[model samples]
Target chain A: MTLQSSPRAFDPSGTEEFAHWLDGVRAWAGTAAPDMSGWRSGAALDLLALPVARGEGGAGAGFLATCRAFETAGEGAVLSGNNVLGGFLFAMSAHLWACQEPLLAFGTDEQRAAYLPDMMAGKVCGAFGATEDGAGSDVMSMRTRAVRTDTEGWCLNGVKTFVTNAPTADLFLVLARTSEHDSYGSLSAFLVPRSSPGLSVGSATEIVGPAGARTAVVRLADVTVGEQACLGGEGAGFAVLMHAMRHERAFILAPAVGLMAGMLRRTVEHARRRSQFGRPIATYDAVRERLVDAALHLAAAQDVLRATAGSADLDELDQARAALTKLHVSREFNALSNRLADVYGGYAMMPDTGIPQLIHDALASRFYSGTDDMQTKIIAEGLGL
Target chain B: MTVDDGVLTVIREAVHKAAPAFDGDDETQLITQQVLDSLAVLKVASRLENQLGVPIRDAELLPRNFASISAMRAFLATKGC
Candidate 1:
């Protein structure tokens, strides 16, 4: 029987193409390639340097290509029990969807040409610095300040916490208050380079999950950038950030289906191999019910994603749908992984099986993009009641 | 027999559960005042949805809809909940 796998959800050609592309990434990384310990310094850049991330593969080859490649990588790594691949994809997705896409949309033509090439080639790593110590959920409350200097350039000062890739990022999309007072239009985004004198990537941050990315405190003490560094300019930060959040919600599920597929396949294989009550445990009604229930959830999550992915603009309704997809899929995948562990009994609990790790990672993902509660709010907003 | 009283009580309880600092004044800005973050807004939505037997659609999720007890009553009244 063809084992139910994550790759099966996509066309065979998509799957095959991604497999080849990812293998090429691995080949490029060579000794620096990802391993059990997690991401290496240069490895992630090489992975991001793929044609899809650069959006150079043409029509179905750029955005779609990146999605297919990551999904395929997630499936293979998950099925073969690679812990770090999912994390790698998580960080990469955040960078591509949240950082690069916004730059393309809001950045001046000059800005795109200057940064996109190096970023796409993985030569200059980048991170979005928005979540401050006090401004996570309430982004408008951010304390970071940017004062336009005499030369029309700006000096930024603030501390952004829990920034993924901050430790290694060469470019930072820093959001700060440009106006003296707090209001909707007070914020602005700036493209600051790591070599800037006053900017510093503070201590490394330790977080939950195997997302193969680095996190740290990004502190800007009078960090200065030229006038051309403004992305959407002053007062545009909030809108830019909102756009990022909406897209983050939509595409963050890029690797989720692959994860669920891995869980289903592993669980089915476990159910078939391990015998209980003188037969394969799959014969048990409770087991069958759990499997059936999981399949339904996975299928439902898939349907939501399929319906929502085509959205061109993440308007209110699209945002709501994206929120639903992220909320439902992540929750279902988390619960399903935990159930699979129960099915494996003692074996699943063992580290070698990777079931327990999957459970932990799922728990980590619960709040990664936005929590279930947050998603509920978004969905309720979409419904208009 | 679920009336405005019931809806208000559920909203109050949910608001307090999410942020005890919250008060149910009709014009209080729950969002701007930080009485409820996105997660708390969701908690309130769930409680309202379950108690009123009325599904809160996404379009009505603006601050004006859940800003206060009076706002919530107006919402439920419009829905005939």
Candidate 2:
């Protein structure tokens, strides 16, 4: 499994276990698993539990396997009608890597025992609340405030936007400013439950890709929670957030690799079957090159994705690596999608063909974890530029 | 000139042990594929540094330094890696 310094067109896949699981997931996504409704099959848990339990070193390898599986499942489903594979898989990754992983890394034993088991068992769905209307890129500029009401209680006020899994999340890891200090360090995170008073989830806002992957605003009008609800301690939220973001940014789109592979395969089939000018489009060197590029991108993305996923540390170096993967893989996926659409021609524009839907969905990949622009910032910092 | 097979083997082994998914040749784009991703990069870098007793840090973190095995070999040769 030695990584290549350079590559040519070739088939790429995961370990036997990952490939086997991916096959099952693809079948599930095209059939039962893509259900928009809560299907307590514990599929998400079953898919992810192994890697996450393995910790960072083991988690890296394990997560790469899981992501490879998710890529195929997401592609199979996204190619067909039930792309809830988009929302479900993305939300699952966010919950596991962003919210749960951080908690597992920094949380108390009581905290882990109280929240994690239920989540692992598929008894609960989780959401991460960080982005705000005024604070997308500049997260530290958020207006959300948390005031210490007592040693064991705190009141939080403000709104969180674009919260994934919010429509069904039983719990939220909310970030809020806890001091007059405007520095990012003043920010803190709270583990707020659905039952907490003054905590309200706005109506689910439909987004570009799939219906199941809903986003909404969470407003806390002086919401109060016990000290036990705090993830890590006060002023530790930024560190916690960075840790979570490092994981999320790197692996958020690992499944898109599968999506690209499926698209390329389908496009090739279409090019051969749907001929023009008395010949198949596949005969054209230009069209062939496009397919080859798609294959090349898929291989390249998997390599980087595996590298980021398999890293041992979660420091600045890991952060840069994850940012690079998120940035490169997303842009590459978008390119592959556009190429796929062009290769399909006018029929690609037709809604029934699902190419248009895929195009729209592919565009949304740019914003999932963070935008490519944000990733560039991290990469630039790493270069000391 | 091509990089010596021994250097290539060590780099490949370091990366392979760290991540089992990558199987690119010397001409493969390592950065694009992320075969030398952050975590694996440290492992490979440390392995090289230990093998040669030279620190690879600071200005040496450039992507071009690790874009491919050939690039890495050339870069390492500059530092007598």
Candidate 3:
């Protein structure tokens, strides 16, 4: 379904369309198994394929629609297993640039056509291969290298760590060093199809949050891709990633805000219903204050997130705002989750309480799409400090 | 007069404004470290852009631009400061 008018970016104070889209996503998610693991390969594919089906004008959804869907999914009991997370990450990474005017800012037209349709359709899932074992925040230090081939294509070499869904991904947006010119010109992003030779996903590693979501080391042992695989330009990977990351952070953080919203609601509901000292904990001054503080933070985060996401759509400021949004929301979200656990008290420590799970899930937000420190550094540099 | 003077003055003002939030001379010495750590530079960048009446381009937000008051002045010069 085509959008009525491009969904108008991501407005927290927007109309009922946001609520309606969220309700539909919740209904859809409700139909699935509570365990996100079951949806990993199949249902996850369908969700990723959504944008493709909706078409570039948008699937009658904008950043707000995507955010609402993420919120619905966040509230559900599903583990944010690799497949689930990877699908959304890939979809957002691709759509962030391709869907906008002057198509294919990062990837070439051929790359966009081949990947975007399938990526948007979810027929093929992609992983953002950025964080190497040696590099997390320092993009300039990435060792993953891509050297051009004489016949055609490029050879990729290096390993990526914390790759959310490499095991199941159909392709990867691999950021590798293409030139030794300088730190800025050193890195580039490539659309490396998994079917390419010499590309393999190593053993799945267990992470603290999002069980059943596979995190694995991706080993590129001279993986080769046609010239078409080059995204944007050879040395332009740094630019591409900078552009893509803005939207990626915005989209990812939107869901994160939703997660905070979900956690806050649960915390409040528990406080209101549960009792302590002969009255509901909600009646206690300290608990009430904490809850109120959490609410305010949630509101403020949403405001920042909406403003940052909107600014991205309107202007090209190298995605500094998105980084700012990520840093703020993720940091605040961690605090919010801690408050939630404090409200839950001992129950939060129990494995089955789900509060423990939520807390664990909250911790992962700090690492992905660049750490909070990294976000701060980007914001600092962006701010011209 | 070189634009460096104005840029340095703005940096000084931002540091001073953000100083109250920080404590001690040691911490104050590390203020540059903290402010430049993440996107905090955006706060400083906005301050300079507004104060200097110059649009800060993305490339101009690099360390060289903020490494020193002198560096910031040099960066602004490229923007027709």
Candidate 4:
């Protein structure tokens, strides 16, 4: 798995920006994983400083740039067995910026100006606190309470599960029950700062892939927030979330396109180098078919992703596009990874071969940015079925 | 035409176009295709707004609104059609 810098037509710089970023991160993950339990904190800070914005061709730089970044992350993992948490963070931050229209349409100016900068800079990580133990996809069923304090401020109370970067998060856009039970209007989004009293994060939850990608339980016990903390007005949280989701889906899937490309390249290269029956395995028809299938899937996924990203401003159309893209890319990654694992034979089962890591990373895609099942359902209900 | 009927027609068509992206042929199939997911709902809302020239507020774009053509027409009618 000697990772030579390869040129990609998609990335003119050949992912030099991301390559340098990974080198530093790999060093940290290798040398510091043991001593730095708080390494995530530093990673968070570094992630904020990284030049992954639209200005430096980073966040809000559009889907092509994001796709390149994801591809680079995939390459780093296959070649070096390094995690791409920063890639995820970069994509998420850019996503927030890319879908600013709906947020600006609904969010107050002060709220936008105050949070957008930090979020873009990565100094302040944002979490979508919509999922609960009881309500995963049914966001309307969330029970987190947001009662008004005596001082005309808001206080949030409830447990939020599966919140990424929870403990390291500087601010949380929390959805809480504002009105009453099962009432759509009752739900509201509040910006709860980590420093706020009574706002605490529980222990980090473990996932199969992205071990250091910190996901934690967020517990708010009467955590009070000022008037500015409220997003939109009473019962506008759902709208805010829907808007954010459009952005999340588009940006998140951008990287997935790249991930598959990376996997395809690796599998092809491996086949070319590994010998079987006194010749390169790449000569075999079966191996060629697998590569071709992966390439086709990658092509389809990339097409859908570009279309989705191009139509980012087209309202709900973007949502449908994002759902479609995410579904295609995630499923494609799942299938491609399995094929690569089979090609690698017993080597895939060992940590030393890097195939296992690639598989783990691919597994995360199916579950991230909402599950494939969730994406299908969105597409289905949109048809009025 | 009342504002409601026009809106309802637009909503129905958009939902119809988006529905085929899902699995079932009719509503009674009890099978959800990929098009019914959250992403598809967003597309339906967009198509409704684009085709019908009526702004369907994010809050109003719920699963119930797109339950069926008849349901959508009725919902539009009640919204000051």
Query: Between which residue pairs do clashes occur in model 2?
Result: A4-B24, A5-B28, A6-B27, A6-B28, A6-B29, A7-B28, A71-A255, A304-B33, A304-B34
- Candidate 3 per-residue lDDT, tens place, A1-385, comes to 3233223333423567656545545544444442334344323423443322244423534444455456556554233222233223323333333232112444455666776655544456566777886787766688898999997878999999877666767777788888664445455568887888899998877766653356689999989887777766655555556555666676566656666776687678889899987899999888888888888888888888766655544444445577777778877877777777888788888765456655666677777777887777766756555
How many residue pairs clash in model 2? 9
True-structure RMSD, every candidate? 9.6, 13.1, 8.2, 8.1
Better of 2 and 3 by TM-score: 2
Q: Count the backbone clashes (under 3 Å) in each candidate.
A: 15, 9, 18, 26
Which of candidates 1 and 4 reaches a greater DockQ? 4
Candidate 2, position A54, lDDT: 38
TM-score result, candidate 2: 0.75
Looking at model 4 chain B, which ten-residue stretch has the lowest summed lDDT? B25-34
**Which ranges in model 4 have alpha carbons more than 4 Å from their true place?**
A1-60, A70-105, A313-316, B1-5, B8-47, B50-81
| Model 3: CAPRI class | incorrect
User: In model 4, how large is the Cα lDDT of residue A142?
Assistant: 81
DockQ of each: 0.04, 0.02, 0.06, 0.11
Candidate 2 docking: what grade? Answer: incorrect
lDDT of 2 by residue, A1-385 (tens): 1122101011123445445555656766676553334334523425445345533212233555566666766777656656446656676777777777777767788888888766755667778999999999878788999998866799999999999878788889998888765544466788999888998999987786643466789999989998888777876676677778877888778667766777777778888997889999899998998888888877887788767765633233355677898888888877888888788778887765556766766788788677878788777655533
- Candidate maximizing lDDT: 2
Where is the poorest 10-residue window by lDDT in model 1 chain A?
A1-10
Worst 10 residues of 3 chain A by lDDT: A94-103
On DockQ, the stronger of 3 and 4 is 4
If the candidates were sorted by their TM-score against the true structure, best first, what order would they fall in? 2, 4, 3, 1
True contacts kept of 2: 0.00
Report the number of the highest-DockQ candidate. Answer: 4
